[model samples]
Target: MIESAYIHIPFCSHICNYCDFAKVLYQKKWIFNYLDALKKEIQLNYQNELLKTIYIGGGTPTALDLEEFKYLLEIISTLNKQKEYEYTIECNVESLTEEKVKSMKQYGVNRISIGVETFHKHHLKIMNRHHTKEQVVEAILLLKKYGFQNINIDFIYALPNETIEEVVSDLCNFLKLDIPHISTYSLMIEPNTPFYLNHIKTIEEELDFSMYEKICRTLKKNGYEHYEISNFAQPGYESKHNLAYWNNAFYYGFGLGASGYIPEIRYTNTRNLTKYCNGEFCFNQEKIDFKTKMENEMILGLRKLEGVNLIQFKQKYGKEMDSIFPIRQLQKEGKLQVHNRYLRIPEEQLYLSNEILMQFIDT
Candidate 1:
């Protein structure tokens, strides 16, 4: 009953200083080559099943010019899908033109995720993002003008030296936009990213925690549900595509650096752009072990505010919660609770979610 797909686009007009995703500056010759390789990969990876959701994400999907975009869409729309499948594409403010927005609507994309990172010009400059604040506004307006109603604007807090006051201000600005959904992320400095290599500091842990609390309060006050730790949405606007990932549902992923799970096997495509461009790197898969699979089920389920359904877990895994998870101990420690038949991590404990989730990891 699970149906989803993920496509990774490895080209970006310019790389962000904080980005660690596998990507390269655009070279037109590889455009057609990548399209061919991606099509072949899809053909090799999945059969025609009803696709409930498809997400085209990466180095900036909107980086492709109009002609190239049409070609890419033509290749992607071939996935087997139920009527009314949700199709999401990630875009950069600078790359999403009015023409591109219209063309996306024409091509059947139903969701648009724009990377807004932050509204402060100083933060954008420090992050080395190529777009200005005006571009972000313009992009959203264009999408709305083209009748694209489902929009998700992504933001990041906890930048080095960011104050809690500043974080609240940023959230207020985004709230004013009337966007349907917002994804707010903490700044994690990954090794090998430009920021990490240059030794850029992250926000102080105390300040970061304060910032997170500030965001939760502001979003709730603005009538957005803090459904997932990182996602805030107006009622009924949660991201269906990403929910598939968090719920550990089976999905087919194609293109460079995409990861997916189908039935019992988990797979990750090659990180090297050259390997991904040749159709030889799509099926590097590893079969899931009992412990790894169980850990995934426990951890991924905890990402939602509603948490794991006890009855559904038993139904899916053929095991009782008392036998599998340390649910009782966590409840005693005030980290988690079972309401009705669902186990949920407490809201305040969410910022330290990794610690709570790891308690259930099977060795």
Candidate 2:
């Protein structure tokens, strides 16, 4: 059963240079129509089953004005919530005010993830991010004041001209916030983004590795565990919604440009706003076969630091992981190791995980 749902709000107040998510500028009239369509889509897709987690992400979910946010929250509140429900909403530091934070609290939101890509002014300007460092601090303080302790802050490193010192500075500032969760990312220049349009090149691989190492070292020195490749969290605070994806569990994805996996089918909604507002929800879908499903399970499972549970994997797929894949060969190559019945990438070899995971592909 799908115990989680992800809702997308495809509107941003300002377009960032590096963002390629399906989003448009926020307009009141468009938002109204979009919400109307979103309600229809949810009503049709949701089975009124109890959901354990609900995540609202987007260009910036908090970019919606107060009234629009309330309406969206009201619609979401109708979902059958579980006793251990974890409802999260993404917020941009610039647009998330005290009132907005309070409104989320009033609507049963227990978690908030803020996009504070970097604390450095130069990097912020290059990325076209408008949130000031002061705003981020104030937002966190406000969330804390209102009893919202389950907070997450995002940081990006290895920008166009970022240096080791700069990345460390960003990490230091991030640590100072005392937030429970931190998600760090090394910059990737994806196609169709402003950075790609401007012909931006990625930083050197060595530098990127250095930044990743620093993040791992610093966060580990503190109380945070590197649970996922890009996520660090204090114990008991890992993102349940995100883990549902990494575990290859089923979930419902609603609103424009969202994707979901339901049993054998994986689907993505249309990115075209006009078509989505007209009630055409899905743009692409694939009926997954057994082999494909196992491949997804391996790829997604390896993302977690604890790796795939061998017994659980056998129970779910009814096949031994060693029989289906060359696990013994990978162990000899020093890329992967099975420890305590969990097949995981060695801590020192994590940076090269992509190369190691490729060997498991049946093709």
Candidate 3:
């Protein structure tokens, strides 16, 4: 049973230089039409299963005016949610308002993930993000006031010319907010983004590695669990929505540019706004064959700190994991290990997880 769904709202008040997601400048004229199309898309695809998690991500879901935002929530209310469901909405500090927060609270939004990439002015300027540190604090306080505490803030490190001190400072500021979850990312200059268009380069590989190490160490020291590679959360605060993805579980993805996995099919919606608004949702899809399914199970399962369960793997696929891949070889190389019956990358080697994961690609 598909137990999760991700809804994308592809409109933002301002575009960040590093963003490559499918999004458009927020326009009043398109809001109604886009939301209408989104509602239709959900109605057509949703199977009315009792979802355990529903994440409403962006292009800043908070960018919508109060009426539009509430309308969007109304549409989402149609989805059947378990009694103890986790409903998350991504917000930007500049766009999150008291009215919206109250509306979200009323509509059963239990989690709020904010895009507070950095607290440094220079870094924010470089990224074309306009929220001040003051605004971020106020937004957090407001969310807390509304009895919403399952908060998460995104952090970006390893920017061009970034220093260790700056990274430390940002970490300090983030800790002060006392939020439970943080998702850290190293900046990647994807093609077509302003950073790539402006010929910007990423920080040196060694420095990037060092910064990631610092983040992991510091967060761990502060009583946060490095549960997934790039995510840290206070115990009991991990993102259930994201865990669905890492588990390779089936989920419905709705709206422009969203992707979904259902049973044996994985598909992405059309990124073109014109096409999406015209009800042309699917852009591409691929059938998951048996070999691909096993590969995906291994690749996605290994992302957790506890790794994959060998017994569960055998029971699900009817084959031993070592019989299918180079698990024994990787364990011999000290890159992978079995702890308490869970196969995982050693904590010390997690920074090289991408490289280790690549070894499973064709096996």
Evaluated with lDDT, which candidate comes out highest?
3
After superposition, candidate 3 runs with Cα above 4 Å error: none
TM-score of 1: 0.97
* Candidates' C-alpha lDDT: 0.86, 0.92, 0.95
Query: Which digits, one per residue and each the tens of the lDDT, describe model 2 over residues 1-363?
Result: 989999999999999999989899998889889988999999998999899999999978999999899899989988889999999999998888788888899989999999998999989999999989999999899899999999998888999989999988888898899999999888889899999999999999998998899899999999999999999999999999999999999999998899999877999999999999999999999999998888888888898999999999999889999999888888998878998999999888999989888877875
**How far does residue 148 in candidate 1 sit from its true spot (Å)?**
0.9
| Model 1 lDDT per residue over 1-363, tens place | 559999999899987888888688888888888888888888886788889999999888889989988888889878877787789999998878777878788879989999998888898898888787788778778888888889999999888788887788888789877899999989989899889998999978888888888888888998999889899999988999888888888998788888889888898888876777766775478999877887888799899998989999888788887787788888999999888889999898898899999898874
Models 1 onward score TM values of: 0.97, 0.99, 0.99
Rank by lDDT (best first): 3, 2, 1
- List clashing residue pairs in candidate 2: none
Clashing pairs in 3: none
Candidate number that wins on TM-score, 1 or 2 = 2
